[model samples]
Target chain A: MRSKIVLVLLLVLYGCSFFLRGEDPKLDLGDNVMEGVFFQGGYGMQWVHDTAAEFERAHPEITAYVWGNPRAWDQTRPRFLSGNPPDVFWGIHNINFWVNLHDGLVANLDSLMEAPAYGQEGVKFRDTFFDGTLEEGQFEGHQYFLPITYAISGIWYNKGMFDEHGWTEPETWDEFLALCETIKQTGGGVAPLTHQGKYPSYFGMIWRGLVYKLGGEQLMCDMDSLVPGAWSRPEILEACRLSRQLYERDYVLPGTSSFSHTEAQMIWIQGKAAMIPCGTWLASEMKNALPEDFDMRLMSVPGFRDGKGGIGAMEASAGPAFWIPVEAANPLAGMEYLRILLSRKMAANFLSTVGSVQPIKGSTEGVNVPPATQSALDRIAAAGGETFAFQFSGWYLELENEYRNALGALLNDDITPERFAARMEAMAERLRQDPDTIRFSRSPRGDGVAAL
Target chain B: MSLQNNGRVALLFVLPAFLFYLTFLIVPYALAFGVSFVKWRGVTLNMEYTGLGNFAKMIGDPFFWKSLYNTVFFTVLTGIIVPCMALYFAVAVTRKLVAGARFFRITFFFPNLISQVAIAVLWWFALNPEFGILSNFLRLFGFTDLPSWLGEPGWARAAIVAVKVWAAVGFYMVLYVSAIEGIPEDYYDACKIDGAGEWQSFRHVTLPLLSEMMKVTGVFLLLNGFGTFDVVRIMTDGGPDRATETLATYIYENAFELGKFGYATTIAMTLFLITFSLAMLSLWIQRRDSVEY
Candidate 1:
């Protein structure tokens, strides 16, 4: 009798295990069920959980199983090569992920953009966004992904400081330099401008702004096409010279090399610096870091003598995009979720919550945009400002690093402006020589042949 | 029959742990070696076998050389400074030369208990050139300007070493203290009876017996130095121009930041071989005959 009871209990336990391992009863989608379209959390996917819930409510046939940050591509790529990948991935850095698009790992969204449901919304979508946001997502005239947010790099200043000093905003290069001199003479002690010299991206912003101011939008655009010997040109030389002069005058903060972007911003907030070149995200971040009443203003980098000082180039770069992997268990459902995310309602919600500039058309109503940001938007619209050009997508990381190092050297007076220009030229020459090291098939004309 | 059954059960108990080691350790290491030969851009769906291309590339890579130099400099500095200071403190505590020995022990060991990330952040704040506590204190002494601790290349490397030593010396001090306590009191008593001074007793008797403990500490320090990453990354991110980069941080940046998986794995494999050989050599050299109790 004891042996029989043990046998019965063992059989029941084994039966329960099988029953528990069977399909989830909650998701009863019959034969049309789609799985694995939901992701819980990541750099840019915090909203996906809620978005997926809404998506599921609208489409009951689709079942989504959310996962973690798509196990960084270093780990995930091997799985992709082995024929398994996530249905959708979020938080992909724009420049690096462009390679995935070039390699055909992600679906081409051009056809989807043309479909009636997607096209009508997409055509209006293209027209509604700031001009350069979409360009960052495109390569060789085809779009692989849609930008969820657009980050524009510009100069942010403390209005209260400027006002307290009885100084007017400078409108030209001469005026800007004169303002720096005035600040110095008055013993402001604070730097006129603060930036992260250690980060190549921050220097890239200054370089792009200089290109725009000196040569105008067309010349800046030409530089990106690999115009041979472009850096050796007079305009580029003057920009380097001006940057060196600024450093010599101590116009920038001390120990800039040690500070990160956030640290530099903190200095500005604490009134240690008069100005900072940062992105639109700074407005929200500043609010969070300090009292809500702290006053700040955003404007373009001051321009040169020949150019309008307020007429600066703003960097409207690609932010983050979501991609549906080719090996996904349910590709269409993933794409549908993306579509919902790109919808006007979702765009407004994201903008309100995260202060991200949505790519969708029309202003986000009921979103409490900071007054300083609104003032910046107004300035840009009034000035007819041009968007800055990025030379190579993310593949230019090496080139950028070299340029930043040269700039840092120049800032420390370790290198001459002429030498800096020569180094910049050499970087272009190196890129031209080593096609494999800096490969971008989409832009074959980008072989140091274009001019700024 | 009963003894055989007991042996079988013991083997069964050990099987799970053995399987875990084989899966997690042995497999990943073998896979890392295999991946080192490929040219993979991490995110791409394709990989090409590059043979010895990556290893060859390391020869000319300035960043790799810079990182190696920094790692060696950091290791050498910490290896000498930490153990000496630890030994000094251990002697002081063991000899009862200082009052409140327990307080001193706890104070020295306190830093070791703090997470490296927290310590790095604390140092960063303290060293901030404009408003940091150290900077402010320096200014009060009429030194108006000082190089940023983690910004200038030379200073950055020095700061990294200093921070490592500060966080590490205490733990090693405790180790030395424990080892010194284990020495029989009779040796010291005999030395005193023989008219030997404290310093002479330490030099003649204490030093020789502590060789085993020194070897253990040295090996630990060497291995830890080779793998230094967190403090550098959090404090400097190998910056002010890659002046403070270590092998581990370099590998991470190449793999995650630059998307060069094959290149990063190649670096990791090189580091593994170098560190493994050095560790083995140290262990072999330190394998002295066990001293009689």
Candidate 2:
């Protein structure tokens, strides 16, 4: 009887070892278990499918499957909430990263960044991006988002049209306005500038760059910290006033307000307008419709004459970020997969295939990046190859909404620049008084300098 | 069978329907009402009760008031025109004035068959300033400065109202048509014999008999306009700086977009009360003061 009891006890103890607390979930290296979901917006779905195929081939033991949809975030919300999230996902545009991190839902990726780039000896993953490129993804002094692409926001114009009209891209606010006036007077049917007015948030690129141009880092810091009247500061107000000048002078493309991003983009690409303020993605997003000789190029917003910041200040950020949920079936595997996903070769594939400039340094050196992307890259190089972004309302949806609403009002001429500033101040004050709201801590000059 | 036994049998018959109603309707509504008093994000179990905190916030919120005003404006516009337009069509179709009355009925009711989202999209394209039918007509007639219908403040509000009215007239018209058909043939014969004209017959004979449906439809149109979201979301998204934001859209923005479930529920509760009270009072007035043939 004693011998039988001992045997059973030993068997039970061995069984417990496989099912114990705090053990890492066994890596699903077998052919059936790995999968990834991505938000397939502007970038087509086929690229993700091909990438997954490549990943599977590289890891013969695992059969990785990937799928994406424009509404991926909404479709995957239930899974995330049920603690059955996708192995790897890209969800920043639609999901609240700050709140998710606060709730301990997203995995802390600091350690993952420390891992050297896969298949690249002694080259850490953290060093691949330009300095400050990953700062936008930082929360609470820790990184939670791993950016895949570098998105540059600026004025997109037709190089051919500019040359034909003998119009030089302006380097100052006054010169920019004068160019707009010239376009309005002589462009025949074309307007000076068209905007994606249907989406008010697209105004961020011009506004953020111009804000830094006029107020420098201190103003950005003031805005980020929610200082009283931060929005009403002289330079911020000047930017608003200058932006409104385009609207008030009837230089905006007629019917531009009714246009979606694609519609407005079509107008710009067709040379029906002089310029459209947009991101570097414009050429890739509208490639199918663009005329072959459109000669699309991007220019940073002209520096305000009396501005305090660098003249070459550009609004650039690490974007279309990928993240792993803490509840993921295999987070380690997921992070490893991200390394391969963002590898230099894959970044090159992305540049050639999608015309997107990845945050990975040297990824596009030998690749045939589209001319529009090259123009943006050259301009960033001109800015000393740095990335800078403000995290004011960008970090908080509520404040962002209020800012956009007030900005919309200003653009629509429903309110003066002072009123817009006062409205923003009042709105921020109200939010600051709320104890339950989620607020992000940020520095005046952003969390880190842009990587170089 | 005894009368009490019959009553018991009737109650037994109603039990299944009552259970369904309790489960689907009352339960969820009760949950919403309970949530209105809490500060929950709705994604997790972390909910805190803040009795009347959300309501108090609503009272001080300018967006709420603006949205409420927008909804009321939409409801009033639809309430006034939808019935008039629907009644005219219903009368014409039933009276057999058109050459193909059956065709007209189907044609008039065609829009209701499409989903509201599809309808919104259809109108979105149809109202495009460049290729839209309206814009083409406007430009053809020398209106070169085509207004941005869905982009300007007042124009966006007008666009939403116009779309809602156009899409809704068919449903209400069908309701009026059914009600008109139900009125006895004898009444019309009597009117014709008395040498009553078409207008007089419609005013005296047709109108009185259709009052019940008219009341239900009027209140329905009013409530639906107040609760509008799908069309507005697809068309304008309450834009040009929220000149067209309705209460329903604002509630969604707070709940799903901004993650303020508690405050969203509070606003929802307020909207429910306004619509419920209006529906009940209107019914009470209708019961107390409606005319009879």
Candidate 3:
């Protein structure tokens, strides 16, 4: 009897491993119970769970279940493949699972965006957010991602270092190079600028700004279109040549090329480097690591000498966007939860809890913010309406990797400008021929890269 | 009723394990083979039947060949070194010639208890450029231009192999220990009575007894070397420009990072067949050399 019982139990467990609950019993969502999966931000995961709990209170009948995972995107990959993905994707990573929208796995958020926001009277959901947030999330010319958290990327610096040294901020290519020279000469083992070396993807901030400075928007357009000779343009060669000057002149911190992002950031915060290219969240990211009076500041990438473009442009992206999967069992409830998420109260809650900006305009005006965050906002306002810019790497991951490899080679002075451009051209050409590649195009609108 | 009923009950008892094996192992292996003949990105139901197209591309991919070379190179190193070193340590512990034999046994096996990722991270710190123990030790000798153990191509592959052997030798040593302990005491006694030295006794009595365990550990290391990932990923990430990429990392990059599941599965299938055949060949050789005890 005992042998038979053990055998029966083993068979049952094996069968249960492959079991799917299938559709909810009774096939009814009128019960108002639903699940929302979100990406847990580094600061905390409780923000989303609290928001969900508040949402349930407002609509008393609805019981919203929230699951916040740091790896929510990859965790839900199998479900997305099997056609039953989680209702929502909240926080974002460099690799977004929503890029599979072309596969009809994600629901278009157009209808939700068209509706009036939960508590904002006489305003559409789309109108309440900042310009170009939703535009970045458009796929196949339809709204797919709901832009929520907004972070800007630029060169981070310590004003105290520049002030104490009597060094002036550079506004053009010549001035920037001259400043680097001055910093190198003024060094007590301090580099003029440093960057995260291990993740060469961060090269996008400086390179994007430089390309715009040299080539203008038309060159960006050509590159995005994957034009045959676009990558080898004289402007590109010049950008590569000028960028490599830092390495040649010893302006980069020794061993910076060997450091990871956090390690390099630690070096910068400790005043070992004058500047580091980083995102707006750098202050909050290094809050605990930073000295109490670090006085962090932001600067636009200096324009090229006698350049046609880039005098009034910025590098930024709408990040940590949210979206719903098409096969969500209770999408209506999930969409309603998103409406609550975008509500003013929740937006304020995100700011108070997360210490980052939201996509809504005038959202950060009255909120208590870190001094560095305030400086970043002021700098953006002072840009005189600079065009918000993105590069090929933002759209094409393969092209991004090619640029990273090329830049790492450039830093070591292993490849010249012409060779770097040619190598990149070859990689772009190969990607253009790949049948599996997805393409998105953009042009610099009044402020940001709006979908074309 | 008694004889027939007993046979029927015995078959029923084994059915559950057989079903579980067929469900988990055999089914997935068969499915992976099917997936290789398609052009699926692995996130959808739509898989275009490319029918040997992925296989054809593998022949011309230089990156694939490089990774294969790295895998085979690593397998050969670990194959020869790990077992031999393990056997040496196992003998030292069991020979009763050394003090604190129990302590040595416990100390050697400690590394295998730590997780691979944690072990990789520990090595990463120990091999750090600025403050690493190895770097500091080298610097003390007036070596200013110390090469990064994980930065340069040659050093990176060598460092990975060295770590893997260090971590793996402990587990294999335990296997050697068990076999050495199981050897009948009479053989050692007979050799002792015949005026044999330590080397002669080990050669005549101990080696032949441990042969079966040696062959088993040999096959385990060979297959594992081909399928390695955790350490390689954490240490070099197959870089200094793909210098240390193995078949496992290559497939992972293609499938997860690059979203080319179809081609990745084809490479995996190729890896499986190669290891499977090599394992069979090893078993055959061991059988031919076996002595009935």
TM-score for chain A in each prediction: 0.80, 0.89, 0.88
Measured against the true structure, the TM-scores of the candidates, in listed sequence, are: 0.85, 0.91, 0.87
Looking at model 2, how many pairs of residues clash? 6
Expressed as tens digits, the lDDT of each residue in A40-79 for candidate 3 is 6555666688778888887888777777777776676787
lDDT of 2 by residue, B1-293 (tens): 99999999999999999999999999999999999999876555678889989999999999999999999999999899999999999999999877898998898789999999999999888887766788898888889988878878888888888888889998999999999999888899999999998899999999988989999997898689889999988888888788888999999889877768899999999999999999998899789867555
Q: Which of the two candidates, 1 or 3, achieves a greater DockQ against the reference? A: 1
For candidate 3, the per-residue lDDT at B239 reads 62
Question: Which sequence of candidate numbers ranks them by TM-score, best first?
Answer: 2, 3, 1
Per-residue lDDT tens digits for candidate 3, residues B20-64, read 999999999999999999987787888889998999888877678
Question: Each prediction's DockQ?
Answer: 0.39, 0.37, 0.32
lDDT of each: 0.72, 0.81, 0.78
Compute the lDDT of residue A30 as modeled in candidate 1.
54
Instruction: Output the worst ten-in-a-row residue range by lDDT, candidate 1 chain B.
Output: B284-293
Runs with alpha carbons beyond 4 Å of true place in candidate 2: A1-32, A444-452, B1-13, B96-103, B192-195, B289-293
After TM-score superposition, the amount by which residue A261's alpha carbon in candidate 3 deviates from its true location, in angstroms, is: 2.5
Model 2 lDDT at residue A130: 63
